[model samples]
Target: MKILLIKAARLKSSASRRHDGVMPPLGFLYLSAALKKAGYTDITLLHLALEGMGREGLERELERLKPDVVGISAMTSEAVSMHMAAACAKNGRNPLVVAGGAHPTAYVSDCLEDPNIDAVVRNEGEITFPELLAAYGRKAGFEGIKGVSYRSGGRRTDNPPREFIEDLDTLPLPDWDLAEMGRYKDFVPHSPMLYGRRYMSVFTSRGCPYRCTYCHSIFGKRFRAHSPERVLRELRILKEKYGVSNVEISDDVFNLDRARAAAVMNGVISGGLNLNIFFGNGLRAELLDEELIELFSRAGVKYVCAAIETASLRLREKIKKNADLEKLRAAVKLLVRRRIFVNGFVMMGFPDETVKEMLVTARYLWSLPIHSFLLFFCRGYAGAEMCGTLPPARRIDPKTDNTCFVPGGGCSSQPAWKLLAVKQLTTAVFYFLNPARIFRIFRDLPFRDARLFWFLFRTMSVKFFSPARR
Candidate 1:
């Protein structure tokens, strides 16, 4: 079967790429590899953002390729483009359009409701997607396929959830040949600031054991990871086959298994990959120690982004984001001592949270021994435990809501606008009050990524000088 997989872009316009940076669509690459392994020879991968393709461009491609099946993956932010691309595929073509990725997995009914989308391959698609093709090839319906939700006679049938993949190493490496790696070399979705020109992202693991209420359950709570040996092999390919010098380890919980994490680092050093690495996905701060920090540095880890959701202990409990604040502090100190740049993720405006708690969180984040940090206004999604517990009035708007919802203060005591203003000013307070941090941020550039400095400056300036508050 002729199959076309598209990494649907989430953007207001191609010109404004700040929200969705030029990520290489690692998910689609893996899907392509999976299809190839299933003995599918006629497969094509399209990345709309990287190609600067809109409806017109897509129309031309659809006419030219005339694919039998079109699969589109989209995050919550990319819902608009996801449906749009599906509609494009349906126009004048009898191709089956399948939707996958974070948005579809969480909102299966909505995806299948659309006439453009024939089905949804929920959660992990590496195995299920190929099996789906096999069943379809035999002219069998999707009724028996686990993890598939499809439309049947005006009703949606969602099959039982698929079991998680046990051995990650069995899956082949992503099909980098299918992607426009040259375009991705110019912009990075994670770790925008890097050391070298040729850079890429690598996922060493899947799933998280922690049940952070605000996180997606796509990977499930069971932690599955590529063995350290398998990880080293992937790195060697990036270095040898693709000439990728700088790498972003973008695992959701990379350091979840401390011993395994260390083994991966040790292998990187012994393998002589010499790749400058950054922990773009936030690591659990409490898990790190002096020894692990040293190993990370030795493995060429120049930057770390820790996920410290809230500094307020009360808020942390409310959100179920358990962490040892003291241990996190020590980890930051150790990373700093190792000359590794550090960034943190902090959230504000949880349900029933007081303004004082936000100020405390901001002050704690500012006082941290790190170069930079990101302050987010907390929002919940349809599948998150927090939202499920909220009262009817406070329930998530499934059509318009996801983790990246617009800051509505989220059932908090304060107004959304006030909370946003405070959030922006909280950042201003961190930099403007401590003039030394500006210099420290510049000095702490491990990759000498000037883009980092410029990003900080632009944000601080807008918060301080912009008349309209965020």
Candidate 2:
């Protein structure tokens, strides 16, 4: 049977292009390769971003492909749009719509009978989905499928979760051949450093070792990584074949195993794959030392991003961040001395957080001598370790709304705004507070990308200086 994959349009609040201008849907590429290796080649992959397409344009493409099965990958924030896409695909027709990814995996029942999605895959579908589709094509009862959820007799059947793939070396590299790699040729995210060059993201590992409360822990607490050879092979392919110069290793924590980190770094260095790499989600601050920092620097790692979720020691302990400020400072200093840029990721407002604590975090974030900052609000998805701390209604709202808001919560106050007004204010305050220095730093950046830079700057400015009326 013919299978089609539909990539839903994601919200474009921030235009941070890392590789040239557009980023390819690598998740779909992985699945496409798996299906092809399983002997399913009658597949068509459609990226909504192509042709300047939106959701409706995707619907038109769906009608054009008209496959026997349709699969959509969704994130927590894009649930509403994904459901809409699934609804349009189903359209009262029987194309066997299926949903997967972080959102559907956590909210299986919600995604299953949402009137738009026919079924949901709870865990890794790379292997499970091929079997499910084979059974569907043969008109077999799907009760035996292991990792799928389906509506049956007014109740949902959630199959047991599948095991993680242990040997990633066996799997083929993602099927970039099916995608228009040229579209993603040079997209680069907005950043203070390396502003002109293009960079793309790759995953050398899956899962996280530490259980950060706010992170969606659907992947479980065990860290799994691809072999050094496996990682080097993919990196070489990305650099040699795709003209990719910069790579971002998007793992949950790259230094979970110090030895493995060294091996990967050494492999890249010895393999002669001299590509600029960024440990985007690699190492938390607590894991690195001077030796590791030196190794990473020698391995062509452009930037090291540490999870500096908060500066309040109590708040950091509350989230189980496990980051020690003193050690974090030392690591940052070492990287700074080595001329390597260090980026910090900070989050605000735990369930028990206070305004004062948030201010402390804001102040501490500005104090850090890092290359850049990425601030995010806490998200509580169902099945996450953090979800237990949140109130019940906010966990799974039956109201099928697109906008994610919790009344009086950290995110709700800024419902109309994508980011917290205070966070925006803080970012502006931090950046503008050093205007001449920032202008001097980014003076070499092209003027074409200034629109996004200025928009974010203005967004923060408007929210920062407004007075409180009594």
Best by TM-score: 1
User: Deviation in angstroms for 10 in model 2?
Assistant: 3.5
Tell me the tens digit of each residue's lDDT in model 2 across 98-129.
88887888878668768667778776778888
C-alpha lDDT values of all predictions: 0.79, 0.68
Clashing pairs in 1: none
Off by over 4 Å in 1: 11-15, 391-406, 409-413, 449-453, 462-470
* Weakest lDDT window of 10 consecutive positions for candidate 2: 403-412
lDDT of 1 by residue, 139-187 (tens): 8888879999999899888899999989999999999888767677555
Residue 128 alpha-carbon offset, candidate 2, angstroms: 0.9
C-alpha TM-scores of all predictions: 0.94, 0.85
Cα deviation of 133, candidate 1, in Å:
0.8
Model 1 C-alpha lDDT versus the unseen true structure: 0.79
